[model samples]
Target chain A: MKKINFYILLFVALLSVLGAGCINEQTEDVASNGESGENEVTGTETQIDTIYQFSVIDALLEGVYDGEITCGELKENGDFGLGTFDNLDGEMLELDGVIYQVKADGNVYEVQDTETSPFAAVTFFETDIQDSIKTEMNSQELAAFIEDMLPSQNLMYAVKVTGNFSYMKTRSVAAQEKPYPRLVDVTKDQSVFEFNDTEGTIVGYWMPEFVNGINVPGYHLHFITTDRTAGGHILDYTISSGTIEIDSCDSFYLELPENENYQSTGLSADNEADLEEAEN
Target chain B: MKKINFYILLFVALLSVLGAGCINEQTEDVASNGESGENEVTGTETQIDTIYQFSVIDALLEGVYDGEITCGELKENGDFGLGTFDNLDGEMLELDGVIYQVKADGNVYEVQDTETSPFAAVTFFETDIQDSIKTEMNSQELAAFIEDMLPSQNLMYAVKVTGNFSYMKTRSVAAQEKPYPRLVDVTKDQSVFEFNDTEGTIVGYWMPEFVNGINVPGYHLHFITTDRTAGGHILDYTISSGTIEIDSCDSFYLELPENENYQSTGLSADNEADLEEAEN
Candidate 1:
């Protein structure tokens, strides 16, 4: 009876040791993930998903970013989509009636079943980083680059010719409506650039220029707006217009152009008559 | 007595007619002003001490702009001081220990002290068309123009190495302690690009092969920032440094070089560590 008991105890002890060892091995195996696990690595596992956050030094340093976004959740086979400035591309990516294509970079993956959460993004940069944060850019580093890239008025010119001349000019507004757009140059005609539906308020000038390698002076008119659009499209808003005029020297000839909507007022150049009326 | 009285009356009537003509000329001149007394053909007066507000826009139509400020009095032939971001001969121009350069092609004026208010600050492209409501860019246009001139990131890559190989990779943070600095690739230990302390940020990247005519990898670095310069200095604070590491089989080993400041941390082969930490 004693010998039998010893054998049973020994057998139980051996099984317990094996069980503990197996559990440790399983934990270590799971922890050894190339991207998310806690295990130590033995070889290169570049084909994996990782998460990284970037640090932004300046609060005012915000603008458009160019990158990619994957599925909302993790899945096998590494299927995902991509996003660029005005468009998204991938395998059957259709958002709001717009189709997108994939980036073909092989580092993106897709999430299954969930629709509200769009995509799960990833990167392989040795230092884990996200598109918004890990741009491989620092504050000072970005500022320097921006300084060099700044647009200056040095490449443009301003000219004025008044006192009885009817020459042509061009007005060029941005493809999208941008508020406080740079007023480059204006036309020689009496046309005015109007703002949003605010009648009798001319805010810009109409200048002409060439298009498609052809000199189409005054063919294209431009105005400045504070609106934007990815694909160039005109907005459904009211606009003000300005016109040119020539007045006689004797009359109080204010060059207020005639407008069908806004009545044009006339003035006489008679100085004494105007002064007498003011005094009375 | 009757004949003399008749002659006097005729003389008085003729004098009145001539005076009326002169008065009419003055009245016409004022009317030609388009009821905009401040709208002179020369230029709008801008106050040097005035403050302007600004903002950024980045939809399809992207821009930055300054809002509004009172125009300062103008002086003829003023000896105005140099402004910021002014370029001299394609390089940033320096005057009185200040860099002054504008990107647009327009007339540059030196403020003179002869007039009542010779001092003047800058405005942006104008679009307002309400008579003398000249669309000289309020603050918004100026802000947008400056913002547009900044640089952007085109491409980025992640770097990783496997095994226990030791190597050295050194590059220059050329815009040290500057507002927005640029990074340059250095093969041989030599400063290919000079530094600008006042601008104190990495402004651009000087590729080794293209800039120095050397056969090297496209080890190009691009950096950009939007933080404005304060008191003519580039940087407002310091940023932390980065680290380097290597990948083993299923585990990642932190690699630390002798006397190196970077902190090397271990990463898993599947990136499971990073994933879990993010959730927490």
Candidate 2:
């Protein structure tokens, strides 16, 4: 009887083992496939929309701490590195003194120096170079606009010049955003400029909040400002710099450009070409 | 030779079966432990936080939204039903228009009526209380101090809020730290206020940005607007009626009280105290 009972237990255990064994084998195969599935091939879902920031000088000098990292960090990771023109499925352009590689996917980064890094060999695309010059702005217009846009409350503004720049990994740092407002006299004498040493007249208009915000007054606006200051940065090729500050309570609506393509001045989107990327 | 070969194959197969069988037994033991581990007398490291939104009227009249499910969809499941005050761990406070059960652990959910559903049995923590009070221009003293503390350009700011009300969940949608400027205006209307007739004082404050942003306001400043209005919510009454629009922004400045205890002016820290117990 003892032997019979022992054999019954043994047989039951053996059958359970066999059943579990086969199930385990099948489950192991499923688990292995599921674990490695993530790395097999980059899923179409892996392709995500990402934005990068690039600093002109940082790319050329092969240095870190550029605008590219600042902008990229604002969105997600701050890992925008320099790229070469050769491997890019896009084009390249030279603005001011810096070289930029613009990718077909709308990614713009600093072009690496070919001589320094073997992998940095790049192709510069200069297929389209139009002399993007706008009609000049009269002295009355520039002066009137500057006089009108003075801030009432105490305010501070910043201009990002060529240098080492860094931004928080995200727009909010520990639940705080928006640039600081410092007490400044916007109407200060140094804030305004009439013209440089050039024979041609020059006028400067400053929007402290506009540039300090995310988007820079891109090239089109730059051209308008430069043209308004006729022969200033445009004719003499000198980077004209200036700002006007106000320290008192003043309510004035500065004249923003009504030009269709100008984004900074709050352009209208009714026009066909203007309808493409009009800023709200 | 054939008999010997058959014996060898059988022995190897038995060994393989034994090894797989042992592994399967061990795996089953581990899987079973998962449930026991959670309910163990000795607490496990596992902890989860969830947030829910309900109006003051809903909280007082019907009790907290009792609709809940244990394993799947709560809404689809049926009447998971109303919540009621189980017991009080510490102090009680008045907000909106009713008396709320304030737990020592800082959990401040509405005390419901039925005991059938989980929501009916559990206590809700007051993580945040929404109101409409203008903060920026209300007090010159507070406004100037906040303005002075604005961080410099490219520098990150760390602002926090801690007080009576919800702590587990915040208006934390999309992780943008800065509250929307328009929301501030929307909540600024005088019509949004209902003077607590008993105390004869108004309650509400301007809502700041929910999350961080490129150019956003700080969370502490929002606290100044929201938590300090009408000299604060009643220290002993439950929320009677609240008409405030809150997104995920409630999470803003949530972790603040965890690190530092703020001198919460409104309704006392009873709500905040109830909500933070599980976190510690």
Q: Give the candidate number with the greatest DockQ.
A: 2
Residue by residue across B5-81, what tens digits does model 1's lDDT show?
Answer: 21333443344345545433443342222212322211112211111111100100010111111122111111111
Who wins the lDDT comparison? Answer: 2
lDDT (tens digit, per residue) of candidate 2 on A134-214: 333333433344333322101111111111111101000011111211111110111112233332211111221212122
- Where model 1 places Cα greater than 4 Å from the true spot, the runs are A1-68, A72-280, B1-153, B156-261, B264-280
For every prediction, compared with the true complex, DockQ reads: 0.01, 0.03
What is model 2's DockQ versus the real complex?
0.03
Clashes of 1: 136
Task: Tell me each candidate's TM-score.
Answer: 0.15, 0.22
| Candidate 2 whole-model C-alpha lDDT, 0 to 1 | 0.21
| lDDT scores in order | 0.18, 0.21
Per-prediction interface RMSD?
A: 39.3, 27.6
Model 2 chain A: weakest 10-residue lDDT segment is: A167-176
